[model samples]
Target: MDENTAFPGASDESKAEYILSNVAEVVERILTFVPTKSLLKMTCVCKLWRNCARRVLRVQQNMTWVSASGPSNCDGHALCPKLADEVENIYILPKTVLVMVDSETFNGQDCCYKQKKARKSHHGPDSIEELNGLFPKGCDIMGVATPGIVLTPTGSHSGAPKEFQEGEAGYAIMFPRMEGVDIRPFHFCKNTISEANLVEAGLVNNTDLRVVLLFGYDAFKPGAARFLNQVLEPLARSKVLIAGGHVENVFSPKRKCCDRGSYGVVGLTLSGPKIQGASVLLEQDVSSAKAAEAIIQRLKAANLPERNTLGFMFACVGRGHNYYNNQRNVEADTFRKVFPNIPLFGFFGNGEIGCDRIVKEDYNLCDMDSDGLQHGYTTVMTLVHLG
Candidate 1:
């Protein structure tokens, strides 16, 4: 039978249905190449398009950083509802950490009080009360620390610990619920192995230049080389500090309490060799431009896609405008020079978290390898190839 004759009696509604079915298939293919923000907007086009976009656009992982003036005045809580409106679920970094927003300085106690109030208001009554009940008396709420000089989102100051000021407060949200990607957390204890053994363990391979290291108070005090030597030893020539610092991992339920013993290094690891990392220690002589160059070289070596790649930057609060001679956003600006049009989001963390390498075995929450590490005075960058 002729093609036209086959559907000659089809009603207008039937023809429209046929056209939409074909269009839906085409849209599914197109959605694969659409960036996340664009895909979210596409959901508003129509219900059919929304369903297709939702099915096609899978966000395997999402990390968002938000900042506002002081803790009491900050709107960091708004990030939750905003993200919930877009994605199915989210996991926030348990602490509502504070960063120095402006040049004014204040005391740590005052900053802590304001931060506590911020968390109470942001997390709501029940979650905060539950967290409080977990700790014994005299311990501060979850993620609340004595305010100190920390990295700011503005990127204009060097990460210097000035007296606490009437600055901004912010926190990070990490969501790994996307499809087609496996997100897991791993932890590596300090001095657990020799340099040779770490390499043998596949934790410090030659291609593994980007690893997040979170040192406890004892470990962080020894200086940068001490911590760098633990994983980046022998291959000390490669750039690795994309995100890390002195922050402790209090959120992990595996730990009994939020104390120094719980303060080891943890990180998320990817499955392939395409990823590379570079770090700049503000305390060292390295410049932000130089650090960005190291990452550029690594990306070139990997032959990463020029587009559709995403970047997450975790910088020390001390490395902003203060470090770059009052210059504005030098750290992020330098990174953009290489991955110019890619999507990037991160915050100036008291400590930054980034992954190193993937684990081979399956794991549950209680038995997972590591959650990631926290470090101070460093910038950790993670790059993912989406195409």
Candidate 2:
């Protein structure tokens, strides 16, 4: 049909614009009806439609849950063909692909992102060549990246910190999609961390940093210990929900999940209007049963305003099934009882970068004056509330 018949008094270009604008208008109305968690996964469609509507069709929502699948054997696709297929880029949103296998299987090099088969994305950049101008100035990235809706128009720089070298056995391909919707990255290198560095990284001396995801690598316990003394000691009074592990080399006869990276120490500071967090630290000096009792008491006594949507537990490798007298998921199972049905994920390592501060419901007051220290032989848990 001619443009004159459909859109009278409009030129060809104008008619095209009118049709696109109407399409965007319909999508905008649909967005308001979508659940908050699902709404976050829905992007602006593309840069073209994004510009056409500009502000009208933009949607704002928080990420409550992220689908995590696999232990897939990518080499053969024989072990987990279904899991391998799960990660196929059907959603169009970027996903953080974490692959941890032995050096024999995956050489800790280029194969980390081998599974992310590039197919034509209808709404995203048509080609890798077109990703040039989307990221703003000073937002340079070291490795490859895809521009996706990471809760902002700005770029979520993908790659390891410059300090990390030849990290092997395991690698994490952090696509734009992460557990965090609103977040910032920070690094601590060569045992050098101060107020200045913290400020520059948006870790400390800022109102924005509320929750943090940290990873510390050391054979001994000094790295995590020093972090707590130097970093958390100063901000001992400040309420920061810290969650992460002090990564140690684990050699198990029955290997579960493994990651090997020379990643010294890294963190992601989380903050946004939609993010609310709570945390707890449980010591394991006593018997497993007693420790579980303590965790129950502390968590139950504490009050939280919003329901916990997700959880992260950074626990000691020593405190698992063997420690719990052949009982699997004792710690995790304990957590589930308190905040039932809340999605939780974490790892077992030598040390943890974690703590908890339960606030009063009406007063919104912190209950304990405990310093959030992460050392070996303790369990640190962080529960997330997404508004």
Candidate 3:
């Protein structure tokens, strides 16, 4: 058979379209085997091909993960079946799980949660067990219940990569893990490095990223500058990607009361080889529009690769649509203006740790502003370059 025997006189584009159409529709399993990059490229081949290829991607993604929000008290336990139903294959279990709940959602007992449904009662430990059931094996679980609006990822949150691009990423933490009490995350901000807590947070010399959550007040204490510097300096020297934030209203003297005591850090140290990335903590004492514009400028300057990227944005709740004249998702909107294809997820917090480093040469950009890692007004955006 000659190259295009069945469509001998067909134009090359027509032949290509025909082949893609048949593959995308008829041999759908083959489409599943296709790389996401290639599938995305196929979408641009033409409208008909685009629809066919995209349907397959959508179907596959729908089978693999779920996104839920708006009021019901859905913890990891309630999450497993929805997860099993959505995902075709299980992504790897995380080395750890980070839980963020509004102070209301977390009952005083054992971090277990009551119902988000109209009528319900449930045990916190049992809920944890149900969540652990979602994992293939026993893995460390930690959490924070905040007095401010609590934020959490709706679907899969594969742990952050450990090591990236032949080196470790940046890192930091606020409080130490609570002693003896299993599964309770720290809620303080001693951000410095002491021998005991390093073991608690699991920091090693060779790692890619670590996320630390601090109580808002501890972020303001006297030694915060020194502690955060000690925590970030070595990682910066090794050229790692670091990002963090403080729990809002959790420790403010006038803030709503929370079950956990007033100090400590909940740190998740991510160290693995499958992903590499950068962080740009953009800040300025200016209008919301101007501040977002400044972030956009710095992102452009970073010049990240335009493919296989996901963004994690930790913005101060202080600056949102209201801050942008009641416009919604302004930070997300501006970030998309820079990398429209990248999916972004994160929280609005009391304060954050931000940096701007695209490559090894950009290491100096990893440090927070002169005031230090915990600041009330900066947008910390990180680009996870999928490996």
Candidate 4:
């Protein structure tokens, strides 16, 4: 065929360019839907495909990262201005005392002298309001004190006061707007109680399960008995025995006695859309790979979005290295293997706050307290898809 006939009014180079452009466009579109792990693999296909994949991964605009800094001498007051300007709400995971002072009081210019006593309740409105007042007007706040360290943009801190030790105490804020995606809280039981038994115990109804909180201490004989009764009664009533599975026990050296049971453990179950129901993976005597596989299976079963752009992992402090055979970050690595390229941030917490399921009976109650159930010895993953 003649040159014009073969090329259709285009040179050989131009024809090749036109075909490659179309291929790149198609590849970019496909990459958007592909999991981050697979997308990374696709980068080896060609330079054009690699470039397209990188561009798509980098331009994720659904999540915003905002941060600010203050003098090292400042306490929690230093965080107020920076937080007020950027964060609408705050979740405090404090390892030490976290005091919130009014901006004017902090500046020392005007002492309105509102010496309010710091509330002793956890996750209470009075405490939340005090934290909010530290910031400018119109800023809302909520937080839970964690026994473990807090991770911020600058660096991880124990949240201890500088007077006690030399370290910067401040806040790191990440704003994940809950406009489109479904945010479901999950709790996984380490026990091997059968689903049938769980149903009989009134813990689970068909697929729905209730979150149970267990409190115990070694010093209190009756308290331990009561705790055991609380757990065993349901099983006893149903005549079900925990045949096999890991039972998680969190021990605190700081806890010497139990006036009313100093130790506590919370249980949660999956709830929400049928497809979005929580996945309760039993991790007792299971390898990290196995646990991760189970989690991936549940995610796939729930039909989670193929493109999970952002993730927040609330893992128990005892889990990461200890549970994963001394391998550091095996849990996170396992999650990355399943949902690659997603931006994940979270700290190992002594107790995690996430919902076990959606509260339908008390719709208003759910709205009022959306904070999920508190959990221990579990890793809760809150994945977000901005499709």
Candidate 5:
């Protein structure tokens, strides 16, 4: 059997399909063997191979981290003053789960690692090789063979490996996990861009992308406008017009006129070229009801197509009652007002991703920007269309 020769009794299309399928299978195995950045380069072997392999490398799900604290023991008091003081400022549980650790805990070190190692070594042979085998086949997340370490992002003590290297390749891999919730954590280093680099790495192309999800950090600073614009400007100016193209996708919730004291206010800002003719209701000092009402009215006024558009929502984890006493208060209600009956699911993201192309605007060399950095008490929501 010659390496260049086609299989007997097979047409060109069948032979090509066989080659492409073999490449995909090989790529799947290679995900465990190499880093994501390297895997994308293999796509150049062939067109069909690149397209299918790309999907295997991209982050398919959104992840969220929730923080909570439990009662701690003190020598004399029912509540530990140390934990009480910490909760007083944050007003949420500092510990997401019950941690059995020594009283002598260090500030920089996660004492849990010691306990985890002890448990693993005494039972199963615990190593990165063993951990990687635990990943279910065909499930996304690179299926890389490594000891999985989940981390908490907004904790006094963040949890993640200080450094981890892949087998023999010596390339460092950063695995980010959300400790408190079910949402899958998609870890990305500071532009190290291994498996998570979507754009330049060519993992998931814009043509395959049906929706662009966005999530902001804690507080929305005026300065973040630049970062938000960076992602939005490019999409607005894309040759491949977005599904809603800005106009059809915008929505506004109905406002409640009655007094709901101290209730958090949610305002929708559907700006840039994404919303074709849609106008945002930028009303300040208004009650939650008024703001929501204005949004709905404006959504109808935009005169866009009404389709079955919804599958996911993007909001900050801190914005919803995860930080307050009210559940599904502002975020859940806002989506209901606009879409009425579409399913809404999203996570509170540390940062958001959208196109930097701003429609109807002239620009050159659209470089990536992180100007949308924010922290504390803000919710940026987006309605996703799950094809």
Candidate 6:
């Protein structure tokens, strides 16, 4: 028999231990260049390899989006084929609620006819009128952030719950600083009626929140923003810069007021110690590999307090694998580098949510959907430092 093949009666536990020992060495040797997909396949080569892979995949600490949709077809497709066959706790968004609008809907001339007509029919001026009137007069009138309508010059659309303005030229999508929506599913009550409430509640019991990362499935409802802003305002005031997701122009006014806000769909806030002497990498500035390297160097460079652990979460858009094979793949690559031993989990989303504050050129509140809008090509990832 070959030296590689094991005897027929070898136990799974023994095989796993053997594989884990070798895998650990491999991780130590090629930790920098190892690809997660390749790592998964290597596990299938033997019973021992399978065991080591499971241990590596098991999440010890994690941050996940509150709401997300699973792959449209996970049984056969490869959205996350490596982990596809092994993951059991995957969270998927309900199929009925998310909808996709063609680019024509936003650019065609007749696209907003129905919306404009509805406004004319209203006797006391429609909600859109009321919201638009709120904007500073002669302000070039970009977009509106409201609860039921998101009107842009290109097109005016109505969902149901709320809307956030998409700034001028539609160059950016922004989440305005406003109160959370009054939707039932997201209603905030003392009994923990909403996801935010649950997060807040969880925070109370565990006081180890040094670096907090908030992953949004979509923009913050006006009400939700109010709560988050108020809660996090203190942190920002204390020099804890809130970042992630893209809303540069909207946040320009307050740029000097905090750390930085230049990412596109996710917000990452590291503690002061975590940021000490560590170089910064805006999401747009680097690929997953470099991002991972930045994270590892930062963590290793800083001498964090006891019990500190890094956590990450991401809200993926329904977009296809065009950007770079797949958004999740990019995410996984970063994970392998920064916190190889840490736990991680998340799901694809309809809309990404980030910080509660609104930037100048970000999407207005008008575009938010009652059921939440789904953009095909967007992703939001969050990383938290847990102690």
Top candidate, metric TM-score: 2
lDDT score, residue 64, model 1?
A: 33
Over 4 Å off, model 4: 1-73, 77-140, 149-282, 287-294, 306-310, 345-347, 350-376, 382-387
Task: Please tell me which model should have the higher TM-score, number 2 or number 3.
Answer: 2
Error of 5 at 10 (Å): 42
Residue 376 in candidate 4, Cα distance off native in Å: 5.7
lDDT by residue for model 4 over 90-146, one digit each (tens)? Answer: 222111121222221122211111112323212223323334454333222222222
lDDT of candidate 2 over 182-215, digit per residue (tens): 5555555444577888777777676545666666
Question: What C-alpha lDDT do the candidate models reach, one value each?
Answer: 0.40, 0.44, 0.46, 0.37, 0.29, 0.28
Q: Write the per-residue lDDT of candidate 5 for residues 1-387, one digit (tens) a residue.
A: 764465877788887667656766654554434434445566787765576555554432222222211222422111123322323333111111111111111011111111112221221222222322322233222111111111122232222211111011111111222221221212121223233343542223343322232222211334435433434454444432221111000001112331212111111122223222222221223235446555545444433443423222222323344433343345345545665544333333333233222112222213332332222233333332211
Residue 52 of model 1 has an lDDT of 76
- Return the TM-score for each candidate structure: 0.49, 0.58, 0.56, 0.36, 0.32, 0.29
How do the residues 264-302 of candidate 3 rate in per-residue lDDT, one tens digit apiece? 344444433434567776674544655776766676666
What tens digits encode model 1's per-residue C-alpha lDDT throughout 78-137? 222333343332222212221112212111221111122232333333322333343224
Q: How many backbone clashes does candidate 3 have?
A: 23
- TM-score of the candidate numbered 4? 0.36
Ranked by TM-score from best down, the candidates are 2, 3, 1, 4, 5, 6
Best by lDDT: 3
True lDDT of residue 59, candidate 4: 52
Per-candidate clash tally = 46, 3, 23, 3, 31, 57
Q: Which model, 5 or 6, shows the larger TM-score?
A: 5
lDDT at residue 366 of model 3 (Cα atoms) = 49
